[model samples]
Target: MRIYVLSRQKLLLGLLFLFTVGGILAITQFTLTTPSLVRTPGTYYMANTPEKVVALTFDDGPDPIDTPDILDILKEKEVRATFFVLGKAAQSNPDLLKRLVKEGHEIGNHGFNHDYQQRHLVKEMNQTDQAVYAATGYHTYFYRPPGGFVSKTQLETTNRNGHVVALWSVDSKDWRNPGVKQIVDNVVKNVFPGSIILMHDGGYQRSQTVKSLGPIIDALRARGYRLATLSELKTLDSETK
Candidate 1:
């Protein structure tokens, strides 16, 4: 009887452990997927405005092949975007970084080497900031955590460094290489007023991203949405308030 009782207690303990783990995972998923819930004082996923303005942001870039093409498309469309470029990439492709600044695109730090560890947050950000400034002579006020995996401590460190943590409301998922149509549909269907759309210009083969760019721009414009840089979108949001 004692052995039977002990076995039952062990089963209860095992179930309790499973429940705790599941609850933690559920919270993490919610925080990652729901921009509004996760946004803290220094983070912005979407602008709180009724204006027909949206921000388009690119991450992990300044790619030698794909970035130039993406820039050309943006120029042709008369659209300005914010690029959250990695430090190493910015250092290696300084000319591309300069071109980005010269063409009036905003630059943000994506960390030095894409390190997402809490302990390395400050160093990664500072290194990226230095690289961007050295290349473009422009200071960036925005920082995007690698993979959107930000801890509270990391967010606090970022804010302490005078950077706004930028997240996205509409994710194009172009990084997945899901296909050009799927990428376009994801942006067009999900974007709303003051939405910040996430796309990638580097970190992998981004030919599809470049191809989908024109269509995404045209569709959004047709929907009466104006694409703005991250800073401009913030201004619009503030003005409406």
Candidate 2:
């Protein structure tokens, strides 16, 4: 099981190889390097820290069904997470956005659409920011580019807009509808201190994702890991620096 999960991890890392030479790209600092708590300005992957903590983050969400179910699970477990929401979804579900903030979970911008190769980067960021602000009156502090694809231009725009580019170290791959147990192992086995675990709440059926939440939270807690929102993790990164 460990080998299988490790292979999946390797594959995801390759898919997310990230970064560029000159024009701007993602740095591969998310690859579990200890004592390398280096902070790349305007961007974040896994924080370089040794605290027994990890952030639970969801992307492409604010789905009325799956998101609420995920929220219910989170609420029942008394765990707070960070949610990356689409602009259109947030516009459609203002109440959900308010609920997330009211419930103490942090919200992030996922873009106006899920165009992983979107061309209108600035527009997408603006629209999502507007939708979030309209719904909750909170400007998003974090932004995850579509499909974790960041360009130099996007980074500059995000910085100008005062948003941090967020990435993940551990991917649940729940979008593949991989079994609940596999999803659990994908996250549980890959996490290190200050790891950011990515899962999805919207964009699909996501029942497996909803189901895996309890076990993922339970396993991490049992292993003496404290789950946190990405904001908290970033704050820790700053204080330690």
Q: Highest TM-score: give the candidate number.
A: 1
Superposed by TM-score, candidate 2 places the C-alpha of residue 103 at a distance from the truth, in angstroms, of 0.4
Report clash pairs, candidate 1.
Answer: none
TM-score of model 1 vs. true structure? 0.86
Tens-digit lDDT track of model 1 for 1-241 = 3554458889999999999999999998887765534555557888888889999999999899999999999999999999999999998999999999888899998988887564688888888889998987888899998887777788887899889889888889998899999999999998899999999999999999999999999999999999999989998776436
- Candidate number of the best lDDT: 1
Clashing residue pairs for model 2: 19-25, 19-26, 37-48
| Candidate 1 error regions (>4 Å) | 1-41, 239-241
The count of backbone overlaps in candidate 2 is 3
Error of 1 at 173 (Å): 0.8
In angstroms, give how far residue 32 of model 2 lies from its true place: 20
